[model samples]
Target: MKELQQLLKKFFGYSEFRPLQAEIIQHILQKKDALVLMPTGGGKSICYQLPAIYLPGITLVISPLIALMKDQVEGLIANGIPAASLNSMMSDSEQQQVKQLCIQGKIKLLYISPERVKAEADWFLPRLDISLIAIDEAHCVSHWGHDFRPEYTQLAILKERFSKVPVVALTATADKVTRTDIIEQLRLDNPQVFISSFDRPNLSLTVRRGLNKKEKIKSIVHFIRQHRDQSGIIYCMKRSDTEMLAEELSLFQIKATAYHAGLSPQKREQAQDDFIHDRVDVVCATVAFGMGIDKSNIRWVIHFNMPGSIENYYQEIGRAGRDGAKSDTLLFYSMSDLIVLRQFAEESGQVEINLEKLNRMQRYCETDICRRRILLSYFGEEVEKDCGNCDVCKNPPLRFDGSILVQKALSAVVRTQQQIGIEMLIHILRGAARAELTEKGYHLIKTYGAGRDLSYVEWKEYIYQMIQLGFLEIDYAHANRLKVTPLGTKVLYGKTTAQLTKYMPPEPEKKKTKASTGKKGFKAQPIRPIESESVDEVLWDALKQLRKQLADRESRPAYHIFTDDSLEDMVAQKPITLGDFNQIRGVGQIKLEKYGRVFVSLIRFVLKLPKLEG
Candidate 1:
């Protein structure tokens, strides 16, 4: 423990370990396997990094991205630790040098992609001495995980080859099923599992549904404008959308850039570098952007289109408040997005699983309960209190007795013998005289046209809600026929009651009032709130400018020198001397020796500090 603390302070420049970093590191040192389930920005890198410092031969980290490897390797090198990466991005000669370093016991940590590891097995077979194997993004090994990769399934080879070596698998996103799949696929030998809380209180979460593209762009522009000069990312669902939206933001006079896999590696690197250097205020990108970004002051994240799964959504939003600073996230959703995702799922081999996960994502957007609660619940975590920061918590939807509506749908399903799709069910309820219904029924069923008061779209929304609320299940193997669950059976037989959020129409309301489903058509409710607390704007701006100047001089990202959180702490504390500055969170001995005096002077100038402060 003492050696770990001394190493942490000397190399990482931190005084203490986050939640379970120390425990995981010690477990690895004792040669025990561990499976770590932490949230993104939960200091996952340190769990393996600290172990590498103490482990004997070498710690080989299997990362998923070249950019992720480069970012981590550069940070380690900057701290005077011996780290190197072997990827396709490096020249043959460069790769040979790193391999030599590994053999010579000079490289304590090595980063390689799964593909590189697979390709270089011949080279590693004869002579590779590894003390620890860390699988970053271990969730990819599972087909059920949000970002499933077939390449990761091959990672079990490491365990098969080195049966005696202890392994540590880590990921930021995974539910119970995903966790189990990861463990089985990676072939961990009864690894110790560490699951942390999924709650991220620093992020204010909100979702806006049923919006057109115009409204979505308008809302996103407004959100970006609110954060003015801070760095933020706008995630779109496609490369084309990223390019178009980036152009749109540029027309609006916001400094923005587009990032996607379609771009050449050079262009993508430039975009990432510019964003990191604060030359770009907004990055309109696809999933390719945030996975590798280490920037710490991203004040906002906006999903221009809905993500395909809850896991993807959470991981993307997790990128926003990494520094534990106040941040905002807005997700725009519509039924069109759902249709698009369904098409994708239909084409996928795992149609059943993909559709189920997509259903959960849709439920989250349409839910009237607290958004955070639904998100946490998806990860198997329960929250009993309103998070107060999300859209639903601030302006909750009105709940009403939905027994009549539910009973009508269930009766229609029963009359149809429980073997019908949503469209057929809706048609039967609305008394639509289609050829199929007419030929089959002879207009004799008593429950026909019981839902005539509801439109096609309204009935569809209600059926989807009932499915999500656990009253009904879809039999995918049986042509997606509707099947009643125990809850649905009770509700249908009058043994139980149901409550739901009253639907809202698209038309404008005459006045602002809570929506009530009292025999009137539902009207849409608009919700938005100004939730950010006021900070020291003058000091914030001055400190940012100074940091940028220092970054420009050092040719590095501003956050690399001193993060925004650290600068904010400096301003708030008004540190005057070396000792006072040393007490700041991100300040370390190396930074204090190289750049601390300059930052201290800047802080003194900004605060008009006295020669000494008691």
Candidate 2:
């Protein structure tokens, strides 16, 4: 433990491990297989890394994202830990150099893609000490997991090849079913599982129904403009949608770029690079973009089109506010998005979704209940009362008696032979004389004139609710027609009664408000530069060396222990004692207790001082 402490101080410039990190490290040191589910920025990497330094063999880290792997490797090198990644970017000689380092036991950790495991096992697994195998983003191994990668399935071979080596699997998101699948498929031998809560209070979630395509585009532009100079992403469903939205945002002179599979690799890389370096304010992209990106300042994630599942929704939104800074997640939903999503779901090749998941998603989309409450409840997390951040909470739309309207819509679908879509049904209800209505048969149906009392918009909203209530199904490719599913048939036959909620718009905000568009918390604190650099260049290089050593030993993110913020503050204040270190803002109690002593000691050594003045 003393050795670990010294190493932590020497490498990461920290005095101790984060919460639960020490326990997790001990398990790996004892050769116990562990499965860790930690939130983003929770120090998951350090769990296996700290042990890797102490153990006799080289530690193998299996990672999925090339960007994440590259970023992590850079941090490790900065901290003086001999770490190298074998990814697509490396040349043959570079790969050979890294392999030689591993073979010579000079590398503490070897990061490789899951796809490399089976193919490279014979080459490296035979010669390396192999103290432990750590699977980063372990959720990808599960079939039910949202970010399922085909390459992840090959990870199971780790247990088969290195049975005695301890295996640690880690991820930021995974529910019960996904958890079970990870354990079974990874072939773990009774792994110790750690599941962390998925609550991010700093992020506010909001879902708004699009008035129309043009209105939806306008809202996206408005939000990007609202958070000017902050980096963000706009997710679209189609490649064409991505191109058009990028074009529109560019027209408004927002530094926007488009990313899709359709783009050339060089263009895609350039766009990603631009977004990361702040050359572009926003990257309007398809679902393929922005996974495993490490840029810490993304302020918002806007979905111009709704994602297919709740899992995808949560993950995309999870990308924002990663710096523990306040962030916003805005989703633009419409009846058309629902129709398209449902049609895709119905046609989806996955057999496990069944009818239950379909109904649940529909209810979530149209529910008059609190949007955040509905979202959290879907994730099996509880949120009491309404979250005032959403459209439904901000502007509570009026609720008229929709029981009559629901009955009329369902009756019309049953009478019209469920193939007719929303527009035809709405026309028939509003008593509009369309040629298709006359061609279909008699415009004299009893249910046709029954809904004549409701306006076209009002009646369409009712149909949307009925669909949400499972009494109607809108098939988009089938001419955007409505089909009465078995459930709808039962409701029409009076075998079951539909309890449909009214569709309401968001409520307006109250009068009292902040005058500035800047974030509420986290005042604009001046960031201090490295003390040694400003004071004496030689001393600054010494401090950097010390930080590299500490980062290597602690195996924690260099940024986490003392963010560039804390480092700057350290140089500015030059605290010479634990108590003095506590004076800095943002140094919370947990951090002060764990790291105060080391930072103070470093300061005293550098300045040739005794105790701190304060």
Q: Of the candidates shown, which would achieve the greatest lDDT relative to the real structure? A: 1
Model 2 agreement with the true structure over 1-614: per-residue lDDT tens digits: 78876666555555667678877888788898888987665567778877877788789999987877876777666556788899888899999988998999899988889998888888677788899999998889987887788889888888988999999999877777888899988998899987655666567777765356787787777777677656888899899998898889888998899999999989988888677655678999988886657665578999888787776777777778766667888887777776667777677666357234555655666667677777667657796667777666766766555555666777887788776777788887877888888888748888777777767656766676777667776666678778877877676666766665455543333332223232222112221223322353323334334543454456543444545435556667777677778765335455667667766766676676775444
Clashes per candidate (backbone, < 3 Å): 3, 16
- In model 2, which regions exceed 4 Å deviation? 1-20, 53-57, 343-349, 354-359, 370-400, 404-420, 424-460, 470-480, 483-614
Stretches off by above 4 angstroms in model 1 are 124-128, 399-536, 610-614
Query: Model 2 Cα displacement at 506 (Å)?
Result: 4.3
lDDT of 1 at 351: 96
TM-score of 1: 0.79
lDDT of 1 by residue, 1-614 (tens): 99888788777777898888888888888888889999987889889988888878888899998888887887787677899999888898998888998988899999999877777766663377888999999999998898888899999888888778889999999989999999999999999999888889899988876566786787777777666666899999889988888889899998999999999989999999889888889999999888777777888899988999999999999988787889999898865677778889989989998899898998888788789999999888997898999878877677788988999898888888887877788898898999998888825688899989998867877887788788888776577789888999999999999987766543332332222111111122211112223234445555666666667777877777777778778768867788888877777667777766766765665555754433
- For every candidate in turn, the CA RMSD to the true structure comes to 8.9, 8.1
Worst 10 residues of 2 by lDDT: 520-529
Against the correct fold, how does model 2 do in TM-score?
0.74
lDDT at position 495, candidate 1 = 94
